[model samples]
Target: MQINREQLFRASCLSLLVTSLSFGIRAGILNKLGVDFQLDKAQLGSITATAFWGFPLAVVFGGFIVDVIGMKRLLVLAFLFHLAGILLTIFAQGFWTLYISTLLVGLANGTVEAACNPLVTSLYTDNKTTKLNHFHLWFPGGIVIGTLIVLLFNKIGLGWQVQVGVMLIPTLIYGYLFSRLDFPVTERVASGVSTGDMYKAILNPLFIFMFICMFGTAITELFTGQWIDVLLKNVTDNALLILTLDTGVMVIGRGFAKPVLKKISPQALLLISAILGAIGIYLLGTLTGNAVFFAAIIFGMGVCFFWPTMLGFVNTNMPETGALGLNLMGGAGMFAVSIYTMFMGSYYDRVVAEAHGNGAFAGQQILHTTLIIPCVLVVAFIGLNIYMKGRAKKSAAAVQV
Candidate 1:
C-alpha cells in the first residue's frame, strides 16, 4: 500500500473538524435544548456532559485495541457513530433521546482522537509535539467554522437541528477520505515496543503525574469553552463572539506552533499555559463586555497549547506507553470535565437561586470555583518542568559517557 502523508493528515483534520463541529454547534444550542425540553440547568448539563463522558470511554478503549483493530477501523466506527449521533440529535424529542445521541457523538469524537493522535505521531516522528499542535489547530478551527455557521443559520431562522446537521458534511468527507487511504501501523507496533513494556511504562511515576495533570488541563480548556455562553451571559450578549475570537486566536497559535516550540520544551510550554490560564480565568470572572475579549486572548493563548502539548508530551517523552498512554491522558481529562460540568451546573442553580436569580454572580462564582483546576496545574507543571529537565540532563550526560 502506498502512503501519502498529506492525504492521511487531511483525513485526520476533517475527522477532528466533525468532532469540534459537534462541540461548537452543541454549545451554541444548549439553551434551546433546555428551553424546548423544559429542563433545568442541571439536566442540561447532564445531557451535554455525556459527550465528555463518552469521549473518554471510547478513547481509552480505542487505545487498548487500536493496534489490533487498526486506525482505519476506529475511524470507520467514528464515521458511523457521528452519523448516528448527529441524525438522532436533529430529531431528538426530549432529554433521554438527546442524551443517547450526544453519547454517540462523544464516542465518535473520542475515536477520532484515538486514531488521529497516534497516526500523527507515526507520520511525524521527528517532531511529534510540533506536528500534533498543527493537527489540533483544527479543533478550534472547526469551532470557529461551526460558530459562524450557527450565526449565519440563526440570521436566516434555521433551527438548532440544522446547525447540527452541518456536521454531516465534514463527517462524510472524512469517512470517505479514510476509506481511500492506506494507514500505517500505530507507532507502538512500528517501533517494536513490546506490549509488556508499554504497560509497565504507563505505571511509571512521571507518566502517572502527567496523566493526572490532564484532568486539570482538560477542565480548564473544555469545561470553560463549553460553558462560555452561559458563563458570560450577564457580562455580554457577545459571548459567542468572544468564543469565535478567542478560538480564532487558538487557531493562529497552533498554526504557528513550530517557531514557539523551538524556543521552549513542551513541559515549559505547559507551565506557561497553566499560568496564563489562571490569570485569564480570573480576569474573566471579574470583567465585563468587550473587556472580556482581552481576557479571552490571554485565555486563548493559555489553552491553545494545552490539548496538543499534553498529548505531544506523552508522545515525545513516554513513547513506550504507546497509544494506551495517549488515550488514557485524553480520557482522564474528559472524565474530569464531564463530572465538573455537571457540578458547575448544579452549583450555578444553587448559587443563582440563593442570589435571587443573579446569573452573573452565579457564573462568576463558577468561574472562581473552576479556577482551582488551573491553579493546581500551575504548581504541578512547574514540578513537571523541573523533573523533565533533570531527566533530560541525565540522559544527555549518560550519552556523553
Candidate 2:
C-alpha cells in the first residue's frame, strides 16, 4: 500500500503524543508528590524507575513485534496499556498500587517508540533525519503539554489522582485514531530483504554509533526532564518558572534545530550538540541564578536535534535495513535509558543518604547528578562523530573511484 503523508504525520503525532505523555508523567509528578503526597526520595525515584522498567522489555520486544506483527497492532496495544495505566494511577493511593500503574504506563511508553519510529521512517524514506526529528518533536512537545497541566492542577489545588486521570482524554483520542488506521508492512516484506542482512547492517560501526547517540540522548534529556523541577526548587525561589524555562528553552531549541540539520552535516551537528550538553549540565549543576536558566536554553539548543537526528541519520544512511533499524534504535535507546536511570537512581539514593541524611539535598540533586551519564557520553559522541564523518567520506570516495 502507498503511504499517505497526512496519515503518516497523524500516526506519527499520535505515537509521539503517547510517548510524551508516559515519559513526561514522572517529571511533572515527582516534585508535586513530594509537597502534596509527602513522598520521600527513594519512593519518588521508584515512581520514575517503575515507569522506566518497561524499557528493557520494550526495546527487546517492541522491535520484534513491529517486525513480526505490524505497527498498528503494537500501537493499539500501547494505547490500551496507557489508557489502563492512567486510569489506575488516577485512583491509586498506596505505594504498590502506584508502582503497578506506572509500570503499565512504562509499557505503553515503550510501545509508542516501538510503533512510531518505524512509522515515521517508513513514511519519509528519503529525508529520514529531518522527518524523524519532526516526528520526535511531539515527545518533548507532549512534555510541554504535560508540564503545563501539572502546573495548572497545582494552581487549582487538585489532588494528584486527578492529574493522573486527566491523561485519559488524550490517551483515548490517540487510541481511537490509531485503531482505524492501516499499517505499513515491514520493509523486509516490501523490499524482499532477508532478516540476516538487516542484522548484519545493525551490527555495523555506523549503526553502533547510532545506538550510542540514542543512549546518550535518552539519559541527558530524561535526567533533566524527570528532575528539573526538583533541581529548580533547590536553586530558585520560583521553581515552577525555572522548570518551565528549562522546557520552554528545550522546545525553542528543537525549533531551531529543524532548520540547522537541513543545512549542516550530522557530524557537525553532533559535535556542537555535545559541547552544548556539557556546558548545559555544568551550568545546571553549578549555577543558581537567572543566569543558569539562560544556560539551559543554550543546552536545549545543543541537544534538541540529538535524538531524531541520530534516528534520521541511521534511516537515511542505512535504508536497506528497513523498519528493523528504527526498532533497533528505539530498543537500544530505551534499554540504555532504563539501565542508566536505574543505576543513577540507586547511586543518587546512596549518595543523598550518606551526605545529607535525606535532608541536605533533595532527590532532584542526586538525579541531576545523573547528568554525568550524558556528559561522559557526549564526549564519546565527539569521537563517534569523527569516526562517522571519516567513514562517510571514505564510502563516498570509494563510490567515486
Candidate 3:
C-alpha cells in the first residue's frame, strides 16, 4: 500500500477535531443537563468523569494492541463508537444513559489519540516536536469551532441535543477519510526494538519522573478546561465565549511552536510554561468581571503546549519506549482528569451549599483548590529542567572524549 503522509496527517487532524468538538460541546451544555435532569454538581461531575475514565482505559488498551492490530482498525472502531455515542446522547433520558453514552464517546476520543500520536510521529521523523505541535492545533481549533456552534444554536433557540448531533457531520467525514488511508508500522516494531526493551524504557528514572509530571499537567489543563463554564458561571453569562477565547489563544500559540522551538529548548519551554501556568491559575481564582479574560489568556498560553510538548519530549528523548510509552503518557493525563473532575464537582457542591447557592463563592473556591495542581507542576518541571540540562552536558562531554 502506498503512503501519502499529508493525507494521513490531515485525516488524523480531522479525527482530533471531532474528538474536541464532542468534548467542547459537552462542556458547553453541562448546566443545561443539570436543569433538565434536576441533578446536582456532584452528579453532573460523575457524568463528566465517566468520559475521562473511558478515555484512559481505551487509550492504554489501544496502545498495547495498536501495533499488533494496526492504527487503521483502532480508528475504525473509534468512528463507530463515536457514532453510537452521539446517537445515544441525543436521546438520553437520565444520568445512567448519559453516562454510558459519554463513556463510549470518551473511548472513541482516546482511540484517536492512541493511534494518531504515534502515526504523526512516524510520518514526520525529522521534525517530531514541531509537527506534533502543528497536529495538536486541531484540539483547540475544534474547541473554537464547537463553541461557535453552541453559540449559534443558542441564537436560534435550539436545544443542547441538536448541538451534540451536529458533531455527527465531521464524524462521518473522518470515517470516510480513514477508510481510504493506510498506516505505517510503529517506530518500535519497525526498529526491531524488543517488547522487553520497551518495558525497560518506561522503567527508566527519567521517564518515570516525566510520567508523574504528566498527571499534574493534565489536571491543570483539562480539569480547568472542562469545567471553565461552571467555574465562571456567575462572573459571566457568556462562559462558553470565555472558553472559546481561552482556546483561541491556544490555537495561535501552538501554530507558532515550530519557530519558537528554535529559540527555546523543549525543557526550558516546559519550565517556563509551568511557572506561567501556576501564576495564571492563581490569578483566575482571584479575578472578576472583564479581567477574567486577561487571566484566561495567560492560562491558555501556559497549557497550550503542555500536552504535545510533553508527548514530543518523551518520543524524542525515550524513543525506545515507542508507542506503548506514548500511550502510557497520554493515558496518565486522562486518568488524572477523570479523578479530578469528580473531585472538582464535589468541591463545587460542598462550597455552593455552604454559601447557600452563591455561584461566585462556589466558583472562586473551586478555582483556588485547583490552583494546587499547577503549583505542584511548577516544582516538578523545575527539577526536570535541571536534570535535562545536566544530562545534555554529560552527553556532550562524552562525545568530546
Report the lDDT of model 2 for residue 101.
85
Q: Please, what is the TM-score per model?
A: 0.99, 0.90, 0.99
| Model 1 agreement with the true structure over 1-401: per-residue lDDT tens digits | 89899999989999999999888888888887888899899998998899999999999999999999999999999999999999999999999999999999999999999999999999999989999999999999998988888888988999998899988888999999999899999989999999999999999998899889999999999999989988898889988878888799899999989999999888899999999999999988989978999999999999999999999988788899989999999999999999999988899999999999999999899999889889999999989878888888999999999
Total backbone collisions, model 1: 0
Highest-lDDT candidate: 1
Q: Which residue runs does candidate 3 get wrong by more than 4 Å? A: none
* Model 3, position 282: C-alpha lDDT score: 83
Clashes of 3: 0
Instruction: Please give the CA lDDT of all the candidate structures.
Output: 0.92, 0.71, 0.90
- State the lDDT at 363 in candidate 2: 44
Q: Higher-lDDT candidate among 1 and 3?
A: 1
lDDT of 2 at 72: 81
TM-score of 1: 0.99
- lDDT by residue (190-289, candidate 2, tens digit) is 7777778877888878787677677777677665667676655656665555555666666666656657876888767876777787678767666767
Q: Model 3 over residues 85-157: C-alpha lDDT tens digits? A: 9999999999999999999999999999999999998998788888899999899999889888888998999
Candidate 3 lDDT for residue 398: 100
TM-score of 3: 0.99
